[model samples]
Target: MRMLLQIAFIVAAGYGALVAAAYFAQAKLVYFPAVGREQVATPAQMGLPHEELTLRTKDGVRLHAWYVSVPQPRGVVLFLHGNAGNISHRLDSLAMFARLGYATLIVDYRGYGRSGGRPSEEGTYLDALAAWRHLTAERGIAPEDVVLFGESLGAAVAAWLAAQVQPRALVILSGFVSVPELGQEVYPFLPVKWLARFRYATADFLKDVSCPVLVAHSRDDEVVPFRHGERLYAVAPGPKSFLELQGGHNEAFFFVRPEWERSLAEFLDSTRPVR
Candidate 1:
């Protein structure tokens, strides 16, 4: 009985240490800007024409972006990527948007790719706002003709921006309700809700967003569970949609491209103003 108690004590101590480590290292776990830092490919490689842009945020951070254009564009997509990799890794998505006759403006958040500064929750929101201003102000794209498309962590940034700017539509792919909520889900054994330093509250922001919303998630997603998407959709206002995707978190968009394109096209059509 003494030996069993000793073993239990050791196990408890180890678990406590793990929770402490997770608490301190939360920022490192949230952002992955260092991964795939090299510029892998460009829009030209995918047979798409693009213009490199350097945007200045309100906080004076200079961000790098790519404006991939399509002829007779149905609309423009301001693509905010996930917490991982740089913009160079998102050429496939740019090409896909181009195929759908939507010009894409994908930006590397601060500290990712060619952009400057370190990654932070507030920094990402500022980075997204810079991209939005570039599209609406510099490029002369009307708010009614602009779509905010965010994946994973970017969904939170996009939703926050959508609430303020009132873009034509907002698309959240593999999104979570909030950082603390997701952390709690991912590390159920730990006190993740209290440990989280960042609060990218996507669902809360969705409540303020008046634009049409599309929440897509994959049941097989190993990273973010499908219920996050369901919850986000439930919280979104009217003219909202929930798309069921297949494959893991990263691969779901690529895996269901054909179906995604079809559904997205239909959804975009519905958002058009009736003459």
Candidate 2:
């Protein structure tokens, strides 16, 4: 009987340790590295003059950003980047939007680049709202002239923002339904829903957003699987579109294939008014 009790105690302790390890490693596992990459392309490389801007959140967290303008600008794209990198890592995306004749404002969330404050789900949402206010209130850009583009974790941030602001259109790339859902998928043994501190519930908020949406995911994506994108696309309201690409998570947009750019351009064109 003593030996049986000892064995039970050992098993319980091991399970407890596993849970603790997963809880502590949650943030680290979710956000990857942003440093040690080559400098991102600049507007000069793309033959454009872009303005650098600093925005302050209501909570006094300052963020770094860039605003690139295009000839006969179709609209403004408020870019919410993925979890791992700062705005510099997304220069290619800005260039793509510029090529499509849309002004792009790419901002780094809290705890990224020169941005202030540590990152949390609510904090990132606040940071996105601050960037939006800077563009609409300070720059005088109307809501109807803005497009929200979010990638990976940024997709959740963008979904929350779209629910509140109702932009001209919304785009989610490599996004997930919620952090808990992602956690459950990665660690099936753990009770993720109970332990998760940051719940970026993009799926829960989709029903509230009334604007047009475009969700893009890659079949080869290993980070956030394509099912998350499909689920988000399925729950979104009318006038929505989905694109399945050939590359992985980060490379999907970077591949620069004709089909990728063509699909994006076609989606953007669909937003225009019929003459």
Candidate 3:
């Protein structure tokens, strides 16, 4: 009996240590700012002319962005990228938007690329607001002419901003309902719901958004799971469209570019402001 008690104590201590580690390292696990931290390429490499922008967040963090403009753009896309790499890695997306006749502005969150300061849930939201203000206030672009496009972790940030600003449309690619919810799904053994300090509550943000929404996801998304997209789409109120793609999490958008672009054009066209 004494030996059994000793074994139970060891097991309890091991579990406690795991929980403590998860709690302390939660930010590092969620934000991958170190992976490909340098800018390797730009829109010019893809034959697209763009202007380099430096935005100052409300909290005084400086962010790096690129504004790629096309002739007579149908609209503007405020692109928020995933957690890993900087804005330089999204040249393909900029080219795609240009093909669709839309100006693209993609920003690197703090701590990624040349941007100053570190990333946190609140900091990302402020970074997004800085980009929005650059377009709507500084550049004098109408709110209705800007489309908020987010991918993976960026989807949550865009959703939060869309709720506040009510842009022309909110587009989410491979998004999630919430960080804690996704954490639970990914780490079933850990008590992620309690350990999570980041609350990118995308579903809750969608409830407050009034603009048209477009959600794209793949059935074979190995990272964030298909159910997250399904739940996000369900939570959106109205005038929303869901584009189901094929392939893995990161590869789905590219693998079906032809089909995906068609759907994207259709959705954006439907939301186009009659001028």
How well does each candidate superpose onto the true structure, as a TM-score?
A: 0.93, 0.93, 0.98
On the 0 to 100 scale, the lDDT of residue 205 in model 2 is: 79
Q: Counting only residues 3 or more apart in sequence or on different chains, how many pairs clash (N, Cα, C under 3 Å) in candidate 1?
A: 0
Better model by lDDT: candidate 1 vs candidate 3: 3
For all candidates in order, the CA lDDT equals: 0.89, 0.84, 0.93
Best by lDDT: 3
Q: Candidate 1, residues 1-275: lDDT per residue as tens digits?
A: 99999999999999989988997888799999899877899999889999989999989999989999989999999999999999998887887788788999999999999999988998999999999999889889889999999999999999999999978899999999999998898778888888888999999999999999999888998999999999999999868998898888877355236877899888877886554
Evaluate model 3: give its lDDT.
Answer: 0.93
Candidate 2, TM-score vs. the true structure? 0.93
How well is each residue in 155-206 modelled by candidate 2, as lDDT tens digits? 9999999999968889888889999999898888889998897789989878
Residue 21 miss distance in model 2 (angstroms): 3.0
Error of 1 at 16 (Å): 4.6
Residue pairs whose backbone atoms clash in candidate 1: none
Model 1 vs. true fold: TM: 0.93
Rank by lDDT (best first): 3, 1, 2
| Candidate maximizing TM-score | 3
- Give all candidate RMSDs, comma-separated: 2.1, 2.0, 1.0
